[model samples]
Target chain A: MVVTIIGIGLIGGSLALSLKETGLAHHIIGVDRSPDNQRQAVALGLIDEPAQDLTEAVQRADLVVVAVPMDAMLTVLPLVLDAATDRQTVIDVGSTKALLLQAVEHHPQRSRFVAVHPMAGTEYSGPSAALPGLFRDKTLVICDAPRSAPDAVARVEAVFGRLAMRLVYMDATAHDLHTAYISHISHITSFALALTVLEKEKEDEQIFALASGGFESTVRLAKSSPDMWVPIFRQNRENVLDVLDEHIHQLQHLRELLHQENYPAVYQQIQQANLIKKILK
Target chain B: MVVTIIGIGLIGGSLALSLKETGLAHHIIGVDRSPDNQRQAVALGLIDEPAQDLTEAVQRADLVVVAVPMDAMLTVLPLVLDAATDRQTVIDVGSTKALLLQAVEHHPQRSRFVAVHPMAGTEYSGPSAALPGLFRDKTLVICDAPRSAPDAVARVEAVFGRLAMRLVYMDATAHDLHTAYISHISHITSFALALTVLEKEKEDEQIFALASGGFESTVRLAKSSPDMWVPIFRQNRENVLDVLDEHIHQLQHLRELLHQENYPAVYQQIQQANLIKKILK
Candidate 1:
């Protein structure tokens, strides 16, 4: 099938590569707002070629993907839906779902839109970071599946299955809330952690030198693109805030234990956290 | 030269395996307070044999490594020091340094004791998790080397160098403080993060399925042994508390952004946090 992916950055470019590599898409077209990314995506062969126009890309495509930043997804989805035919399927690979889902909830071609978030990324972004097996063995969350037509949902599922991704289904609101806790807050913590060390310690050489496995893992996500995350945090504000509050409260609890020199309490806190082992594996 | 690892858990066992594989030591011996670990160390061949006594191991050894829990190191070091000769070298792979260094500060064999903290580990511990190259390309922190005899420092550096690990030097106090920020606080945050999610999230299946890469990375250190971390936090209480306070402050700042729904402020906080990009790479 012909697949057209918008944005043509990390997610969009990688998705195009994965689909073509898995033989799920016969032809891949890229639509990016940045002329530079559009040129780079084509130069890198991430797509067959950059689309001449969005409307033209939508009109000829069997599948259209909205992979723009979370903030831009709302603005782009409606316009894409306006150009889509009944047979054409539109999907968004945005990190936040509720906002984008709401933006297209009442569109006449709402059935054409399938909201999917593949929980896959790296510290790097852009066409340079795109890889052929980026989504393999990762969880792909499909939100508000019922809202989309059966054919569209089935087609997306079949495509993701061929890419060897495990699929989970949830509503848009639940997806946003869960991701805020599980995904969005991590980026914020990592960025803040990097900043904290950067600000408190004047030794930049020390951080680079002494960053052990723990610090490297904790601060790895801080290297992500701010342009991508700023809109994600904006789109999922309430849920992100709730999770952030809980996270801060947890830190405060530990802080109090340290202040009191309560070794036993602190040990218990760590033991309790150790339960994440079951979930992670 | 003969090398003896005093505790055959994560750090010690991995070190033994790497030393053996690289032919860094002619004979490798194991010593552990836990009988199970001793037996496992022998079974896994992490060492040539299990030592019934640390002093017995030290007397025959050219290099003796005390890789016990941080708190135990203070009590154990003096006993090991009493048995070591000027020709023999001692090193402790403890997370905190100030206490370990202070405990042996005035020992007659102070020159024999090298305060080394290898900044590498995993959530799981035990001989089974030991790998041949666990320390390859990892950082090893050596503290208060000037107090150590030139030969002792040279011996420790040679071993770490042979393992292809990067060596960094810092004072005992600075090592503890920097570790509290880079390593210890990450564990506390990770543990607290796990506890917070567990308290709020009840469905085991949902948590298992929905816990994304971000949550896993943020909470990974929670699975570290409480026995190991409790002592590190206690030994480095002041530094741990200091970093914990700063981490809480950063969290609160983000919370305020959320509470105000001040999108611009929240965006700015995240953007500021994103500056960690420069330091990490």
Candidate 2:
């Protein structure tokens, strides 16, 4: 199969590597707006070639992977579907699904498009950050799967399966809500934590001298690209807002317990939080 | 030299392993209130023998290590110092230093006591969780060094140096304040994040099915033992509360930017947080 992947950065470049490694895609073409990324993707052998035209690339490929940032995905998804043939399958690896899925809902080749989000990433970006086995044993969410043609959905599942990802199906609305709770809120909290410590560090130069594994892990996501996250938060504004409010409320409750020197209540809350061990493991 | 390590949990047990590996302690002694811990510490070869009494352990060793939970450290540190001779050196590895240092400020053997906080740990606890080189390349904050005898401070420094740890000296008050920003606040945010997601999971069970590395890293410290954290927070309440307020303020600001559809402002804030990349690296 010939596969064309748009925006060959971390997710897209990694996906390209996986497809080639699994022998699922005999020829992989990359389409990126940045010349630097296009050159890096080709240099790193993440893609067979860099496509000069999106419509031409879509026309030639049996499968198209739209892995652009959220804002660009709105226009790119519709364009990919516009050029998609009946036999061609197009899938997006976006973080937020509701708006992107809605953008191409009334398109003529809508049934050929699949909405997917592979739940995996790191705090780095660019083609150089592309990693092998990036999606192994990770969850892959297929949003609004009922709207897509059976063959298209099956092709997406087959491709992700080859990458060793677990498939979970959900409607676009549910996908947005759940990801806000599990993924998006984590980035926000980490960014805020970095800002909090950075603010304190300004007053005392020694503040970060004592930062260890705990602080590093908790604030690691703060280094994620804003170009990627601002769009996600903007696209899923209401759900993101809802989770942010709840997170702040939880922090305030903890602060109140600490203020009262209520060690027992604090202990109970930590024990409750410890239940995550079962889910995460 | 002989070393007696009280409370053979994560910190103490790990220290025993490091000392043995570095040949700093010819004979290591373990002292814990729990019989299970004593058995496990010995079986794991963390110590050569288990001491029957705290006073006898302190008396026999040239250096004493008090690695109990912060609440136990209050009484245990003073007791260990009570048993110390002019030639003996004692150090307590507690998270919060201000209160622990104050508790033994007026002791006749005060100059024999060195208060230290090794700025390194994992979420797990106990003898089985003990690891070699846990303190390697991590910061070791030596608090109120001027109060400790010159020889006592030098001995403590030499031990941590053999474990490949960098040392930073600060007064107890500054140590508590800085740790509140870099360490204590991270745990509270993680615990609160775990509670927020867990609360949402109650309504939708599939929420965790999509959790990825980002979520896990941000919530990792939520798994830390409350037995260790509660006393640290209880002692550093005011400082923890201050950083918590700032963290909440930053989150609320980000939420407002999202609410107003201020993508530019949100992007700027994230870029600011990205400065942590320099400090952390």
Candidate 3:
């Protein structure tokens, strides 16, 4: 199938690579607003060619993958749907879903678009960061699948399945909520941790040299692009705020336990936290 | 040289492997409170044999490595020193340094002991978690090194140097304070993040299915053993509390910005956090 992937960056570029590697896409057309991204996407072989016009790209492709940032998705999804034919399937690979799904709810071509959040990515970004098997063994969340035509949903499932992703179905609200707890809040904590350590590093220049693997892993997501995350936090504002509040509360509780010299309580809390191993493993 | 490694868990076991790999120790004696650990250490070839008596082990070895948790270090360091001969060198590899250094400040054999914290570890613990080259290319902080005998310091330095660790010299107070920002705070944040997600998962079983690499890395240290962390936190209580306060403050600040829908400020904060890429890479 001929696939048009918009915004040819980390997720889009990785998707292009995966689709091509799996023989799922006969030819991949890249559609990105930035000239640099379009040039890099093609140079990196993440796409067969760069499309100059979004409408023409949508019209010509068997599959349209809207892989733009959250803010851009609000505008681009509607435009993509407008140009999509009945036979074409449109799927958006975005972090947050509620707002994007809401943006095009009443559209005549809404049935063509399937909202997907493939639970995978690295700290790096841009077309140069693209790698094959980025989605292998990772979860692919298909939000509000019933809203999309059955054939469109099946196509998305098949594509991600071929890419070796585990599929989970949820509504847009639950997708945003769960992502806040699992994905979005991790970025917020990482960004905060980096800021915290960097703030301390100014006073002790030697501290950076002491950053070990544990510190690196905890602060890794701080390297994520603001262009991708700011819009995500904005679109999923309420959910992110709720999870952030709970996260802050948990931290404060730990602080209080430590302040009281209640080592037992602190130990208990950590033991509780270790329960994540059951799920994550 | 003969080496006796007490508390043959992650650090001690790895140290045994490194020492054996470098031929720094011809014979490695394992000492641990747990029979299972002693058996595992020998079974895993982390040590040549298990020592039945601490005094005999210290007397026979050219060097004694105290790799116990923080709580054990208080009693174990003095005991090891009590048994150490003038020809023997001792080193305690624990996370916090100020308290341990203070506990042995007046010992007659104080010069025989060196305080070191190798900034390398995983969330996992125990002898089975031991791996070769765990300390390679990682920073090794030597606290209050001047207090140790010149020959003792040289021996300790040579051992870690052979393991390919970069050594940094600092006083105990500075070591504890800096680790609070660079190491301890990372663990606290990771534990808190894991707790927050697990709490949400109680209500939503499918939430964990969406956890991606980002979430896993950010919460990886949460799986750290409580037996290891509770003691470190107790010893470095004040410094950990200070850094934890600042970390929580930063989280709250980000929460406020997101709550107010200040995407520009959020963007700026993330951009600032991205400066870590410079230090981390």
Candidate 4:
């Protein structure tokens, strides 16, 4: 089927490559606000061709994928849905869901728009970051799936299935809340951590020389695009604030334990955190 | 040279394997307070044999590798130094160095001990978690090298160099301080992140289902051994508390920016954090 992917950055470019590799995107059209990204997407072979305008792109495609930043997603999803035909399916792969869904809740073609979060990404961005099989064996969250027409849901599922992604379903509100805890908070922590280290590095030039895999993995998300994350924190502000409050509270708890020289309490706290092993590994 | 690894867990076991792989250890002996770990080390062929005791192991070795937890290092280093001959080098791979170095500073055989932090590790521990090339191409911090006898420093350098690791020098106090910002704080963030998700997951069972690569990488250190970290925090408590305070402050800054709907400030903070790329990559 013909598919058009907007933004043409990391997620969009990667998704385009995955669909093309699986032979699902018979002809891919790219719609990016940045002329540079459009050029890079086509030059990197992430899309079959670049569409000069979104109106023409969505009209010519059987599927339209919205991969813009979360803030832009608030406006873009409704615009894409308004232009979509009953035969065409539109979906967004943005990090936050509830706000985007709410934005298009009153749209006449709301049934044509699906909310999806691929639950995958690297710290890098842009067309050069795209790679085939980016979604292979990864979880793909389809939020508010029931709100869409059955055929639209099925068609999106078929495409993701061809890319070998595991699908999980959740409501838009639940999706936003859960991602705030599991995903959004992670970026905030990484950025804070990188700041902690960088602030220290300014004083001690040798500090970075000491960073190893442990520090690298922990601070890896700090390398993520701010353009992508700022909007997410904005859209999911309440939940992000809730998780941030708890996270700060937990750090304070450890700090108090350390100040009191309560080794046993610190040990027990880490043991409790270790339970995540069962969930992750 | 004959070498002894006092605790055959992640760092120790991996060191033993690297020593053996590099032909640096003519004979490798294991010493652990835990008989179970002793048996596991031998069964895994991490050491030539398990020593009946640390004293005995040190007496028989040309070099002693103290790979115990930070809490135990305070006691273990002095004990190993007391048993070591003038020609026998003693090195502890504890996460914190200031307290460890201070513990053995007045010992008669203090010159025989070297303070080194490999600045490397995975979340997993124990003999089974050991790998032959764990330290390859990683940074090894030699703290207070000038305090160590030239021969002691040289022998320790020879061993880590043979493991294909780069050596960086720093004072014990600086080592603890910098690690508090870079390494130790990362663990605290991960543990806190895990607890935040776990607490939220308790409220919402679907939280982990949406956890993506960013979440996994950020929380990966939550799986690190409490047996290892609690002592590091305890030993470096002051530095850790200091860094933890700064980290909490940064998070609060982001929270306030979000709370005030100051999106530009949040974006700038992340952009500043992104400067870590120069140090890390």
lDDT winner:
2
Of the two candidates 2 and 4, the one with more favorable DockQ, higher being better, is 2
Model 2 Cα lDDT, one tens digit per residue, A1-281: 99999999999989988888889999999999999999999999999989979899999999999999999999988888888899899999999988887788799999999899999999999999899889999999999889999999999988898889999999999999999999999999999999999998888898878889999999999999999999999999999999999999999999999888888999999999998898876
In order, the TM-score of chain B in each prediction is 0.97, 0.99, 0.99, 0.97
Off by over 4 Å in 3: none
Instruction: DockQ each candidate and list the results.
Output: 0.69, 0.88, 0.91, 0.85
Ranking by DockQ: 3, 2, 4, 1
Residue-by-residue lDDT tens digits, candidate 3, B111-217:
99999999999999999999899999999999888899999999988989989999999988988888998899999999999999888877989788788899989
Q: lDDT: which is higher, 1 or 3?
A: 3
The 0-to-1 C-alpha lDDT of every candidate, in the order given, reads 0.84, 0.93, 0.92, 0.88
* TM-score against truth, every candidate: 0.97, 0.99, 0.99, 0.98
| Tens-digit lDDT string for candidate 2 (B1-281) | 99999999999999999999999999999999999999999999999999888888999999999999999999999999888998889998989998888899899999999999999889999999899999999999999899999999999999998899999999999999999998999999999999999999889998888989999999988998989999999999999999999999999999999999999999999999999999877
What would the TM-score be for candidate 1 when compared with the true structure?
A: 0.97
Evaluation by lDDT, superior candidate among 2 and 4: 2
- Candidate 3, residue B71: CA error in Å? 0.5
**Candidate 2 stretches greater than 4 Å from native:** none
Residue-level lDDT tens digits of model 4 in A1-281: 99999889989999998888878889999999899999998888989899887788898999999999988888888788878999899989988887788788888999998889998889998888887778999999998898999999999899898888899998988888888888888899999988887887778787778888989998989998899999999999999999899999988888898899888888899999999998997
